[model samples]
Target: MILCADIGGSFIDFAVVHPDGRTEHRRSVPTPLDNAPAFIGALVALCAPWPDMPLHIAIAGVECPDTGIIHAANIPCLQALPLAAHLHRETGRAVRIANDADCFALAEAHFGIAKGHRNVFGVILGTGIGGGFVLDGRIVPGLGGVTGEWGHAPVVIPPPVPLDQEAAETLVPLFRCGCGISGCLDTIAGARALERLHLWAGGTPQTSRAIFEAWQTGDRQAGRTLDIWLSYMGAGLAHVINVTGSTIVPVAGGLSNAHALVDALDEAVRARILTTTSGPLLRRAALGADAGLLGAACLGLDIRAQE
Candidate 1:
C-alpha cells in the first residue's frame, strides 16, 4: 500500500493506493492552520489506518516554491515551514511533495484526458486561478513552482470600473492570495467573484451555482457579469494558449461546476485564439475531487519503482 495525500487550503485528502491502481481506503480532515506541528500531529492521526515504513507516503500541497515552504493561507500554521523534509523524517519512507495545482496537472496529463499530449496545461478556476504545464510527463517547475500563477496576468480595465478600483484590485488583491496581485482574474472570475457580482447587481449574495442558475434562466445581470468574468479569464488564458499552443487545457476548480459560465468561457477562448486550427477544447477533470490524492500517489509510485 502507498499513502497518497492532496493538501489544499481547506481539506486534506488521503488515500491508500494499491499496486493495481485502486484506492483501498480514503480519509479526509480539515486542514490545520497556524501551527505546523499541530497540523502534522493531526496528519499522524489520519495515518493510523495505514502502517508506516512498510507503506510509503506521497504528498502535494499549496506552498511557496523555492523552499517548499508551505504558505499559511490554507495551512496557516505551516507557513515558512519545510513540509517535504518534515514528512520524510516522520514517515521514515521516501516522500515526494509537489504543489497541489501541479499535482492536478500531473494526474491529468498522465492518466486523464491529457494523456499522450506532448504539451498539457492543467488549470484550476476555484478560489483563485492556477495553471501547470507538463511536457512528455515532465512538469515544468518555472521559478520553483510559481509558474502557474496565471490568474494574476493583467487585462485592460474597461469603463464603469474606475482606475482606483482597478488599481486596488491589482494592488492589495485578495487577502491571503498566493499570486499577490489585487483584483486579479481569480478575484473576478472565481466563485467569490460570482457572489460579489450578485450583490453588485442588487441580488442577495448567493452561491456560484445560483449565479449560474440565473444566467441559464436569462437573468440579464447574471448573464452580463458571467460574460465579463469569462472574457477576463479567457483573456489571461489566451496569452498562455498563444504561447504554448497546448491543444488540451483542462479546467478544474469550483467554477468549473458552472456549466453555463463554462460554455461562455469556451466561446470566449475560441475568439482569442491567434493561430491554431487544432483549437483548445475545454473539458472537465475526470479525476474529480480525488485528483489530488491520486496525483500524489503517482509521485510515490514512480519513485518506489525507481528504487
Candidate 2:
C-alpha cells in the first residue's frame, strides 16, 4: 500500500492505495495553511499508522525539480520549502511529490479514459484553467516543473471577422490575467471568466450554470457570450493539441459537468485543429474526485518501480 495525500488549500485528503488503484483507510483533515510545522505534522500523523509505506503527495502547487522548492500560492506555508525532502527527514519514509494536475494526468493515463493512449493531456476547466501532459504514461517534467501551463501565455487572437456583416458585433478585450499577462485564454475561458464574459457581452451577471442554461434555452445574449467563449477556448486548445500532438484529452472540473457545453467545446476544437481524427479527442475525466489520490498512488508506484 502507498500512503497518498492530495493536499489542496482547503483540505488534505489522505488514503492508503493499493497497486491496482483501490483506496482504503481514507480520511481528510483541514489543511494547516499558515503554519509550516502544523502542515508537516498533519501529514506526519496521517502516515504514522503505516510506517513502512512510502508517502506520495499531489499538491496544488509546483515543486521546482532543480531546487525542490514548492510554490503554492494558496498554501503559504509550503512556499519556498523543500517539502518532500523535509518530510522525508522528519518521517523517515520515502516521499514523492508532484503537481496535482500532473498527478491527474498520470492517473488518467494509467487507469482512466486515456488508459490506452500513450500521449495524454489532462485539462482542468474549473475556476481557473490548468493542465498536465503525460507522455508514455509518465508525467513529462519541464523546466521549473511547470509543464502544461497552457493557460498563462498570451494566446487569444483578434476576433475573426464576421462573414456577412460590415463589422464585427462583438469585441473581446484583452483582459489582464492573474498571471500578469494580457490576452491569456485564462481571462475568458474559466468558469468565473465565463461569467465575466457574459456580463461583458451585454448580459446581466449570472452564474456559469445559469448562463449555460440560458444559452440552452436560446437566449440570444447568453448565446453570444458562449460563442465568444467557444471561439477563444477552442483556439487555445487547438494550439495546445497541435504543439503537444496528444492523442487524447481528459477534461475535469466544474464545467465538465455540463455535458452539452463540453460537447460544444469539443466540436469547436475539432473544427480548429490541423489534423483530422475519426472521433472526438476531448472526453470527460472518468475518476472524478478520486483522481488526486489515485494519481498520488501512481507517483508512489513509480518510485517502487524504480527500486
Candidate 3:
C-alpha cells in the first residue's frame, strides 16, 4: 500500500492505495497553510498507522527537480522547502511529490479517459486553468516544474481594430495573472475567469454555472462570453496540441461538468488544430476527485519499480 495525499490549499485528501490502483481508508483533513510543522505533523499523523508504506503527495505547487525545493503559492509554509526530503526524514519512510496537475495527467493516462494513449495532456478547468503532460505512460516533469502550464503565457492580445465605446468599456484586453504575466489564457479560461469574461461581455456578475446555464438557454450576453472563451481557448489549445503532439486531452475540474460546453470546446479546438481525425480528441476525465490519490499511488509504484 502507498499512503497517498492530495494537498490542496484548503484540504488534504488522504488515502491508502493498493498497487492495482484501488484506494482505501480515504479521508480529508483541513490543511495547515501557515505553519510548516503543523502541515508535516498532519501528514505524519495520517500516515502513522501505515508505517510500512511510503508516502506520495500530489500538491498544488511546483517542485524544482534539481533542488527539491517547492514553490507553492497556495500553501505558504511549503514555499522554498525541500518538501519530499523533509517529509521522508520526518516520517521515516520514502516520499515522493509531484504537481497536482501532473498527477491528474498521470492518473488519466493510467486509468481514465486517456488510457492507452502514448501522449496525453490532462487539463483542469476549475477556479483557474492548469494542465499536465504525460508521455509514454510517465509524467514529464518539465523545467522549473512548469512544463504543462499553458495558461500563463501571453497569448491573448488587444485587437488591432478599435472597439466601439461600449465594447471598450467592458472588455479588458490584459489582466494580470498570479504568475505576474498579463494577457494570458488564465485571465479568461477557467471557472472564475469565465465569470470574469461574462462580466466583460456586459453580463451581470454570475457564477460559472449560471453563465453556462444561461448560455445554453440562448442568453445573448452569456453566448457572447462563451464565444470569446471558445476562440481564446481553442487557439491556445491548438498551439499546445501542435507543439506537444499529444494524442488526447482529458479534461477535469468543475467546468467539465458542462458536457455541452466541453463539446463546444472540442469542436472549436478540432477546427483549429492541424491534425485531421473523425473522432473527438478531448474527453471528459473519468477519475474525478480520486485522481490525485491514484496518481500519487502511481508515483510510489513508479519509485518502487525503479528500485
Candidate 4:
C-alpha cells in the first residue's frame, strides 16, 4: 500500500492506496504551520507508527514547485525550505512536492472530468482560486510556479458607454483580496465576494452562508452577485480559452457544490466565447476534495510506470 497525503491550510488528510487505486484507512489532522521543520516533525509524528510501511509523498506547498522549495502563502514558513530534499533525508523515501492546485488538476485529468482530454485546464474555486494546465498527460505547471494562480485575475467590468455615475456608484470599493489586490475576479466572485454583496444589500455578516442559500431562493443581490461572478469569470476564461485552447475546463473546488452556479458559469462562457469550432468542455470536478491524494497516487503510479 502507498501512503498518500493532501496537506491544506486547516488539515492534512491521508490514506493508503493499494497499487490498483483503492483507498484504505483515511485520516486527517490539523496543520501546525510554524515552519517546514516543525511541520515535518508533526508529520513524522503522524507517520511514526508506520515507519516500515511503504510511503511516497506528494506535497502541495507554497514553494517553488519545480525546485520543491516551500514558499506557499498559507505555509509562509515553508518558504526557501528544501521540502523534497528534507523528506528524502528524514524519511529515506522518495517524495514529490507540487502546488496543491496542480495536484488537483492532475487528479481531474487522470481520473475525473478532464480525463481523455489532451489539453486541460483545471480551475479551482475554493478559499482561493487556482488553475493548472496539463498537456500530453503530464502536468505543465508554468513559470513562477503559479500556473494555477488564475484566482488573482483582475476584473474590469467597465461602465456602460454613457458612463453613468449612478451605475459606477453601484461598483464601489471592491473586496480586498488575499493577493492584496482590489477587485480581483476571485475577490469579487468567490465566497467572500458573495458575502460582500450580501452585506452591501443590508444583509448581516451572519447571513453569509444564507447568501448562497438565498441564491437557491433567487434573492436579488445573491443572483446579481452570482451573475456578475459568472460574467467576470467568463471574461477571464475567454483569455485562457484563446491562449491555451484547452479542451477541458474542469471546475474543481468548494463552489462546485453549487450545481446552479456551475450551470450559470457554463452558460455564461458559452455566450462569451469567440470561437465557433467548439465550446470548451466545462465540467464540475467529479473528484471533489480527495484530488490531492488521488493525484499524488497518480504521480506515484506514473513514476512507477517509468521505472
Candidate 5:
C-alpha cells in the first residue's frame, strides 16, 4: 500500500491506495500555505496511521529533478524546499513527489482512459492550461522536471487572410500572457482567458460555464467565440500530438466537462494533425478527482519497483 496525498492550494486530499488503484481511508485537510512547519505537520499527521508505507505526493508545483527544490506558486511554504527529503526526515518514511499534472497523466496512462496506450498526453484545461506526457507508462522526465508544459511557449500564429470579408471580423488580438510572453496559447486558451476572449469578441461578461451553455444553445456570439477558441486550441494540441506521436490524449479540467466542446475540439485537432487515424485521439479523462491519489500511488509503486 502507498500513502498518497494530493496537495492543492486549498486542500490536502489524503488516501491509502492499493496496487490495483483502489483507494481507502480518504479524507481532506486544509493546506497550510504560509507555514512550512504546519504544512509538514499536517502531512506527518496524515501519515502517522500507516507507519511503514511510503508517502507519495502529487502537488500543484514543479520539483527540480537535479536540486529537489519545489516551486509551488500557491503554497509559499514549499517554495525552494526539498519537500520529499524534508518529509522523509520528519515522518521517517520514504517520500516521492511529482507535479499534479504529471501525476494526472501517469494515472490516466496506467489506469484511466489511456490504459492500453504506450504514449499518452494528458491535458488540463482549467483556470490555466497544463499538460503531462507519459511514454511507456511513465511520466517522461525532462530538465527542471517540467516536460509537458505546452501552454507556456508562444504558439499563436497570425490569423490567415480571410477568404471573405466577413471572416476578418473574427481575428483575435495577440494578448500578453501571465508568463510575460505575448501570443502564447495560454493568453486565450484557459477558462479565464476564454472569458477575456468572449469580452473581446463583443459579448458581455459571462462565466465560462455560461458561454458554453450559450454556445450549445446556438448563441451566435458565443458560437463565434468558441469557433475561434477551438481553432487555436486545436492547433496547439495538434502541435503537441505531432511532436509527441501520442496515440491518445485524455483531457481533464473544468472545460472538459462540456462533452460536446471536447468532441468539437477533438474534431478540430484530428483535422489539423498529420496522422490519419480512424478514431478520435482525444478522450475525456475517466479518473476524475481520484486521479491525483491514484497517480501518487503509481509514483510510490515505481519507487518500489526500483528498490
Candidate 6:
C-alpha cells in the first residue's frame, strides 16, 4: 500500500491506497501554510500509523526535478524547501512528489477519462488554469518541473482591426498575473478571472457559477461575457491541441462541472483546430476530487515499478 496525500493551499487529503487503486483510511486536515515544521509534522502524523510504507504527494506547486526545491505559492513555508527529502527524513520512509495538476493528469491517463490514450492532456479550469501532460502512460519530465503549464503564457493580444462595439466597450485590460507576467491567459481565464472578465464586459459582479447559470438561461449580458470567454479559451486550447497532438483532453476543476460550457469549448476548439474528427475532443474528468490522491498513488506505483 502507498500512503497518498493531496496537499492543497487550504487542506490536505490523506489516504492509504492499495496497489489496485482502492483507497482507505482517507482523512482531510487543514493545511499549515505558514509553518514548514508543522507541515512536515502533519504529514508525519497522518502516516505515522503506517510506518515503512512509502508516501506519495500531489501538491499545488512545482518541485524542481534537478534541485528538489519546491515552489508552492499558496503554501509559503514550502517555498524553496526540499519537501520530499524533508518528509522522508522526518518519517523514515521514501517519499515522492509531483505537482497536483500533473498528478491529476496522470490519474486521468491511467484510471479516468483518458484511459488507454497514449497522449493526454488533463486540464484544470478552477480558480485559475492549470494542466498536466501524460505521454505513453507516464508524466513527462519537465524543465523546472513545469510541463503542461499552458495557462501562464500570453496568447491574447489586442487585434489590430477596429474593434466591435462589445469589444470596444469591454476594454479587457492586460491584468497582471501572480506569476509576475502580464497579458497571460490566466489573467482572463478561470473562475475569479471569469468573474473579472464578466465585469469588464459590462456585466454585474457575480460568481462564475452564476454567470454560467445566467448564460445557460439565455441572459444576454451573461451570454456576451461567455462569448468573449469561449473565444479566448477556445483559441488557447486549440493551440495546445495542435501542439501536443493529444488524442484526449480531460477537464477537471470547478468550471468543468459546467457541462454545457465544456461542450461549448469543445465546439469552439474543434472549429479552430486542424483535426477534423466529428467526435468531441474534450471530455469531463472522471475522477473529480479524488484525482489528485489517486495520481499520487499512481506516482508511487510507477516509481515502485521502475525499481
Q: Report the C-alpha lDDT of model 2 over 1-307, residue by residue, as the tens digit.
A: 8899999999999999998999999999999999999999999999999887789999999999998999999999987899989999998888999999999999999889999998899999999999999998889999889999989998765666544443444457678999888889899989999999898889997999999999999999999999999988898899889998999999999999999988898899999999999998999999999999999999888887778
Worst 10 residues of 4 by lDDT: 54-63
Cα TM-score of candidate 1:
0.81
Instruction: Assess every candidate by TM-score.
Output: 0.81, 0.95, 0.94, 0.84, 0.94, 0.94
Worst 10 residues of 5 by lDDT: 161-170
lDDT of 6 at 162: 84
lDDT digits (tens) for residues 1-307 of candidate 5: 8899999999999999989999889989999999999999999999999888789999999999988999898999988789999988887888889999999999999889999899999999999899999998888998879889999887765666544557655567778888788889998999999999999999999999999999999999999899989998999999999999999999999999999999999999999999998998999999999998888899988887878
Lowest lDDT 10-residue stretch of candidate 6: 166-175
lDDT of 1 by residue, 1-307 (tens): 6787767667777778774457866878887776678788777777766545333332434545667675545455776777767766786654566767777777788778787788778888886577777776656667645656677744433345456665655422332334565556666766776677556645677788887888899988877667666767778877787877777788788888876566677677878888555544677777877677766766776676678
Which residue pairs does candidate 4 place in steric collision? 62-71, 62-72, 63-70, 63-71, 63-72, 131-148
Reference-based lDDT, residue 62, model 5: 92
**Cα lDDT of model 6 by residue, 1-307, tens digit:** 8899999999999999987779999999999999998998899999999998888999999998888999998999988799888887777898889999999999999889999999899899999999999998889988878999889877755667988887765566778888888878898899999999999888999999999999999999999999989999899999999998999999999899999999999999999999897699899999989999999999988998899
Clashes of each: 9, 0, 0, 6, 0, 0
RMSD of 4: 3.4
Model 6 gets an lDDT of: 0.91
Candidate 2: clashing pairs of residues: none
Q: Candidate 3's error at 168, in angstroms?
A: 6.4
**Model 4 spans with C-alpha error above 4 angstroms:** 45-60, 65-67, 157-167, 170-174, 200-209, 276-280
Better of 3 and 4 by lDDT: 3
